[model samples]
Target chain A: MTTLQAPDTPFLALDVDRVDANIARLRQHLDLLGTPLRLHVKTAKSVDVAARAFGGGTGPITVSTLAEAEYFADAGWTDILYAVGLDPHKLPRAQALVERGVDLTMLLDSITQADALVQHCRTHGVTIPALIEIDCDGHRGGIRPDSADLIPIGRRLADAGCLRGVLDHAGESYFATTADDQRAAAGVERVTVLDAADRLRQADFACPVVSVGSTPTAHATAELTGVTEVRAGNFVFFDLVMAGIGVCRVADLALSVVVTVIGHHGNEGIFTDGGWMATSRDRGTAQQAVDQGYGLVADIDGVLIPDLLMVGASQEHGVLSIRPGSSRRLPHLPIGTRLRILPNHACATAAQHSRYLVHHGGSTDVVSQWPRHNGW
Target chain B: MTTLQAPDTPFLALDVDRVDANIARLRQHLDLLGTPLRLHVKTAKSVDVAARAFGGGTGPITVSTLAEAEYFADAGWTDILYAVGLDPHKLPRAQALVERGVDLTMLLDSITQADALVQHCRTHGVTIPALIEIDCDGHRGGIRPDSADLIPIGRRLADAGCLRGVLDHAGESYFATTADDQRAAAGVERVTVLDAADRLRQADFACPVVSVGSTPTAHATAELTGVTEVRAGNFVFFDLVMAGIGVCRVADLALSVVVTVIGHHGNEGIFTDGGWMATSRDRGTAQQAVDQGYGLVADIDGVLIPDLLMVGASQEHGVLSIRPGSSRRLPHLPIGTRLRILPNHACATAAQHSRYLVHHGGSTDVVSQWPRHNGW
Candidate 1:
């Protein structure tokens, strides 16, 4: 029963109960899908925060960088898929991990990298597993799902005895307007990974895992037909972006920065210590009908002051203005008024701080301080 | 010189020579204006970096947070202005710093904060200097430059004999498009502080210092007139944003992330490990031009790849796409080809890493590591 003492200033708060609920909700959905959840670690940055999503099991994990892979690996969470394509330079780190008995699978979308990785592995007297990245849609990385590239790369890796399976991240699902759009994106992800898997199988390659993920897609496409594992992140602490994408309710967002009102700019704006550097420059999914500039300003009870939004920000000050067409000067916020702000991107926002000051309402007990990882 | 050597990976590099050059340039300009340069520490989070900027003296610095104020103060660099507006919760931290003989000046913008600070100072038996923040042109914080509000706040503090001077940060000058625009912003900043000083003087209050700054305006406004001290942060490592505002040249940018090529998407694109998380999601000022997506992509030598840009970015993957009209497939970047990425916003970009890998071409060295300060 640890909690942060109420300070009249800005600090990041993690509601452990809300976090558990969010994790349960995501797990329930994945359970219904009968797909293993390979929780993505980029969102939380903290090994402890990420551990909550695992629910006390040695679940497989997805990482965006070697730094994350090393972090989780050091924390005894070894089954990791370095999701970003790898270069030869990472071979040494990968070698160190594998030699230490960690199950590490590198990702790649091109042959040049594959050949180089194979050569590096041969030279090092070690073999590393790899997943051939497939571009389900033009979101970010990957080779075309139906392209001739998949078979060659998949077979080449299999020939090297290091190919794992095919993977695709439906990043576009973050922009989905509705559950159906998310489901559609998820459906496409399944089709893309399964197609690549099928192509590899036809070429006599053993394709075991057809990985598909994106929080919105993972939840929406509960019954991904061919996907063996669902790799999703950001569901643990759903932000305004996730809520805007119809993936979760605002109340489901368990993490927020507790900032204090420091001053009032005339009668128009209230200034706080949370700025772009603290809250991050993420405007959230504001390009849609629901625009959250930076994030939604909320009270301690997690109730959104719909009329108040972080209208502007400097390095260390957030200038919040009342929503247009609304009257009242944002409740006079008053100097020393403590409030929680929901971030747009949980990952980027979380990265701004060194640790999370876990809080339980009305409690003075010191909870746990979760450390975060930084650098490459 | 501490070089963050991770083979050919995209990581931020700080060149001591170029940093010295940039510091020298800012010193020359500040000398021309006949004002002491209170180097802004937000841009370079390193105490060592600030020490280099202060090559002349004990170094009076401006910090964005109390954490930084504490860091530099503990590191023996005493004079600090917590540039951002202050909160009462941090009053204890300030008092502790003052107790340690740190010349700390807390910023106040409203009567409410002024009262609270006064109460805190009284309760703790600590006498701290207070600077009234005046809003020059609403670029960031401060009471309006010409408002009656400025006088009342100043007079109240002066009446209590706690007021030190009036301070203004012309942050809007960062957005200035031309020399005239910078000069105009500088004028606004100068007037904001001078006018507040005038109001205090007219009221028979001895307001000695009038502070105003922003690199663009600091360099452009030669005649400080009544301004006493200037504070500008980003001049330490000129960024792409500074270049876009005509404040410096791209060649003048001294910080960049050296990234490794992981894969290539045919002639369509090339992928690297330096994604938004590495280079930061800041599109810089060029966001108005072509939306450099993440930032301007460069080779290992810091040469901008002609017609090339970071077209897409995820957590750890940056997609380098040649402009649509350009037909050349980049000369085989190949896996492990090291490339340097010029940042969009140096402050945000620099803050992302734990320590800087100081470098000066082939001079591999690890001179110092600076911990980044987060939270209030």
Candidate 2:
């Protein structure tokens, strides 16, 4: 019943063919490493697309939220690694997932959390597998790989019967300025995880997985020695951020926001219904060299105008100004002109929508709809 | 069984008692104005909360999307205004809503849009009431109320037999420095609508309803003058942005994100699981004298910590640093610490979750859950 009947404005549209190509390329790229890819589900919320990613032989996946793990686990995605650091309060939910027969692996970075997990399993009568998060590049969460007593904490968890392996995300790879930077970061991540694994092995713990992944690093690194699997998301529908980082070309960026031109402020700017509310306030690549304000504004044909980015964004209204120093004013697009904007961060942007309007065969008409999840 | 029983580290939690109080205040405020308030359904997407909002008085409401209009209309809140600027491409959805006997008012700013709407309506055999947006201060959408062609466009729509009264949103008042600024902006909005109504009247057109609203202006301005109804939405659950602008107090902010301290970054900083993903990327009051990075981080009891504000936020991690220029580091909040954060913009932050964990009777334990809308 929900068809291509979209307002001339901000709605998420997926090109089925483009998505297929993106999935295939990622599959081919990861296949060469002789390691299985654990696709991260945080990037695309749609189980339909996630299922397509899963169909490519990466049944195991990483999840950012318990809601994602729950939703996908309900949809038959059994192997899930909750990449977010474990919260003691969520022990019940993690135990519930385990009770549901999900191979849910949680991440923890401290002894306090390890003790809490041990206590939760002791109290709840459920054993939840966990991976110790190691700091690869100090981007976000994780304990330093060589921290005193950290490996003993992993041994303590295994003694309590819940430890799984050691993992690292190499999140700093997102900041890599070039492929070489990505490769270097990837090597650092491999070393960090391998070192942590070695320490755990020295403590007589069977560390089966040494996880280190990110789309850029996954493509740049040739070897994953001492790691059992790789995990990377966002390769399915790349964004302007990935394009700017040289991880993928703009042509390979499959996702886009369909918006309508409601009105224009003459030469000053054009107004679209796609504001922070629709396109999301995720200016993921703003810290990079070329700041894509909200996103790179483009026409429906996927042609990047290079002179248009949402300059000023309010809650429900976006002001698309001509890129500074560019002599171009937008050709008087009428009140109904439809435009597509490529987002800066695919994960954050995609999380803002409820579903994907799948478009097939280059038509504006949406042939199918795929629902998305919002909470944990 | 969706018990947020000790929810994950960072997530949004709603206080239903506060929501009720907030709703009561809106009703009392509008009742004092001797005009009915068209509750903006954009603030609370839950149909259940929307039902609660309509419980006090009139059922007529304003919505940001046709999807919302349809959702609430199906729940029997039929008088809906798709408040965003209308696009001709969405004519079919408009037609469908009208055909189902939903009183949907569409907004238009330019005569170009009017022409297209007229053409679309004639082609589709659907009649939509047209509301001309009058710009009060140029914060966002609307034609300048004093524009020379105002009467001509109104008369054109009148001739076409689909014209409604002029509607003006004093959005600029939301950023007012003082009560006087809000009052003046409200007065200007009133004057703009009255002047436009007079122009239409002079043209022998019957302007049934001259509407004006914005929470700041609507709450402060006592006089309605020529206005028939007020459409103010965020008055239900004002946030830090509203508090910073002197419109509402922080205590009046009904929504707060409940988060957990995952780990400590150093001796001085505590890391929480709530990030931009949970609190939203809206730094609503940050541009004011005080910068609420993500929000004013609070304790479970809604007590603000003078030592900290969320200084930096990533997708799933928030760094709580000691306030800048402070003499000392914060007492590091250890892992598993539960914290509640007052949001900068309630609407944006609340939209990130599927369901709100509603706490009852000043209890830290959740008593109920309310579902929220994810998309149109």
lDDT of each: 0.79, 0.81
lDDT of 1 by residue, A138-233 (tens): 777788877877777877788888888999988888778898888899888889888888889888999887888888888888567778899888
Which portions of model 1 miss their true places by more than 4 Å? A1-8, A327-329, A360-366, B1-8, B286-291, B323-331, B361-376
What interface-residue Cα RMSD does candidate 2 give after superposition? 1.6
Error of 2 at B183 (Å): 2.3
In model 2 chain A, which range of ten residues has the least summed lDDT?
Answer: A1-10
The candidate that wins on DockQ is 1
lDDT of 2 by residue, A64-132 (tens): 888888998888889999998888887778888899899999999888899999888888788888899
* Residue-level lDDT tens digits of model 1 in B1-376: 3345554365677777788888898888778867899989888877778888766456888888888888887789889988777787788888889999999888988877788777777777778788988887766667875676767777777766678998987878877889998989888788768877887888888887788888899888868878888988898888878888788887788888778877776677778888767776676654554355666777765567877777777777888887656675666677777777777789888877766777764454546545655455
Q: Which stretches of candidate 2 lie above 4 Å from their native place?
A: A1-9, A24-29, A54-58, A122-126, A360-367, B1-11, B20-33, B47-57, B120-126, B365-368
Residue A182 local lDDT, model 1: 87
